[model samples]
Every structure is written in C-alpha cells, then in structure tokens.
Target: MVRNEQRKLTATYLNGVGMAVLGVGGFAPVVSMTLSGPTSSIVPVLVFGCILASSGLHLLARQTLGGLEE
Candidate 1:
C-alpha cells in the first residue's frame, strides 16, 4: 500500500511538472514574440494549441488511472 501511494504521488508530481514546462517553455516564447510585433501571431496560437493538447492528454491519462483505481 505504501508503495502504491508513493507511485501515485510520483505520477502526480511528474504531471504537474509537465504542465509547468508546457505552460512556460511552450507558450512563453510565443507570447513574448507576439508582444514585440505582429509577425508572431501564428506562432503564439500554434504554441498555445500544443500546450493545450498536451495538458489535455495528461488530464485524460490521470482520469483514466483514477477510474481504474475504482
């Protein structure tokens, strides 16, 4: 039981880290570029889309696992 709890904690931590990276690394640059000029419009959209997609995947995976636990 302890081992299982540790594994779940680790999974949650990793998911949070992945989200942070996607939010910062993936979208921050595009946002900065957009603020500087109009040429970066599409870039921010693309990056934001990617971040959303990835975060969705992570949420789905977590939900699936939680369902399995029931």
Candidate 2:
C-alpha cells in the first residue's frame, strides 16, 4: 500500500509537469501564429489551447485528489 502511494505521488507530480509543458509548449505556437495570422484564424487556436490546458489540469487534479483519498 505504501509503495502504491509513493507511485501515485510520483505520477501526480509527473502529470503536473506534463500539464505545465503542454500549456506553455502547446500555446507557444498559437501565440506566434496569432501575432502573424488573422484575428479569426487565431481565435480558434487560442480557444483550443485553453480547452486543452484546462482539461489537463482537471485530470491532474482528479489524480492528485484520488491519491489523497486513498
């Protein structure tokens, strides 16, 4: 049980790092494109990035909370 707990903690931390990278790395290109492209084209890219980041965070939170509960 303790080993499992440790594993879960590690997974949660990794998930957080992945989410951070996804947010920054994923949005970097969108930010660049928005600056160079038309407003209409950039809007969708920004919205999609926002959605992706939020969902990743939600999943990360769920994983962390589940580990805590266990």
Candidate 3:
C-alpha cells in the first residue's frame, strides 16, 4: 500500500536523522569533556548533548513504533 510505503520512507528518514544526531550528540559530550575538563560548565554541554540524543531516540522510537503512532 502507498500508506505502508510512506511509513517505511518516513521511518527510514527518521532513523537516519535519529542516528546522525545521536552520533553527533554522543561525541559532543566527550569532546567537550576532553577539551574543557570536568567542570560545572560542562554540565550545559552535557545537557545539550543529552537533549539532542533524547530527541534522536524519540525519533528512533517513532520509527520503530510505526503506524501505532499514526
């Protein structure tokens, strides 16, 4: 069905974006920590990374959940 194909397409794009952001977010905290050292200031960077990664995860979850959400 077209709807099913659309879902697959959407899911594929979502997964690509999700994984991309997740990879970037996963490295951000480490890069920040390595460059800046462990400090309260790093908390913001870590939080930013966490937020990005969480958003990516949400997208991935949506991709996995598929039509259940629609």
Candidate 4:
C-alpha cells in the first residue's frame, strides 16, 4: 500500500543519512585525528557521531519493521 511504500522510502533515506554521518562525523574525525594529531578532545566528536548514527539506524529499523503506531 501507499503507507508501506512511504515506510520503505523513509527507511532508505534514514539508512543513507546514517551511513553518511557514520563516515563523515564518526570515522572521518577519528581517522583525521590519528593521521594529523588531535588538537581537541576526540571523545565528544565520537560520542556525538555515534548518537546520530544510532538514532538514524533506529528510525530506519522501526520503519523497516513497519510500525505506524511506534
């Protein structure tokens, strides 16, 4: 139905966003810091990235599982 299609589309978007954030916000900073020497605390960046990635994944999972009330 249209609802299911919408869910799939939303899930796809969420997945893409999660992957992008994981790469740019999470791993990219860690890699950059390791290669160039950290001038600031990497913990905050890692934590922030992880939170964002996990949130995105969580939303994607919910949509993929098909939940209109969730």
Using lDDT as the measure, the top candidate is: 4
> What TM-score would each prediction reach against the true structure?
0.53, 0.45, 0.53, 0.66
RMSD of each: 3.4, 4.2, 4.3, 3.7
* Candidate 4: regions farther than 4 A off: 46-53, 68-70
Say which prediction, candidate 1 or candidate 4, comes out ahead on lDDT. 4
lDDT of 1 by residue, 42-63 (tens): 7767777768766875775586
Which residue pairs of candidate 3 clash? none
In model 4, what lDDT does residue 42 have?
A: 62
Model 2 lDDT per residue over 1-70, tens place: 8766776777677677666656665666568667887546566666576667667765765676565543
lDDT for model 3, please. 0.68
Candidate that beats the other on TM-score, 3 or 4, i.e. the better one: 4
Error of 1 at 40 (Å): 10
Clashing residue pairs for model 1: none
Q: Runs in model 3 with CA error above 4 Å?
A: 28-32, 35-40, 43-65, 68-70
* Sequence-dependent TM-score of model 1: 0.53
Which lDDT values do the candidates have, in the order given?
0.68, 0.66, 0.68, 0.73
Which rank order by lDDT, best down to worst? 4, 1, 3, 2
Better of 2 and 4 by TM-score: 4
- After the best TM-score superposition of candidate 1, give how far the Cα of residue 28 lies from its true spot, in angstroms: 0.8
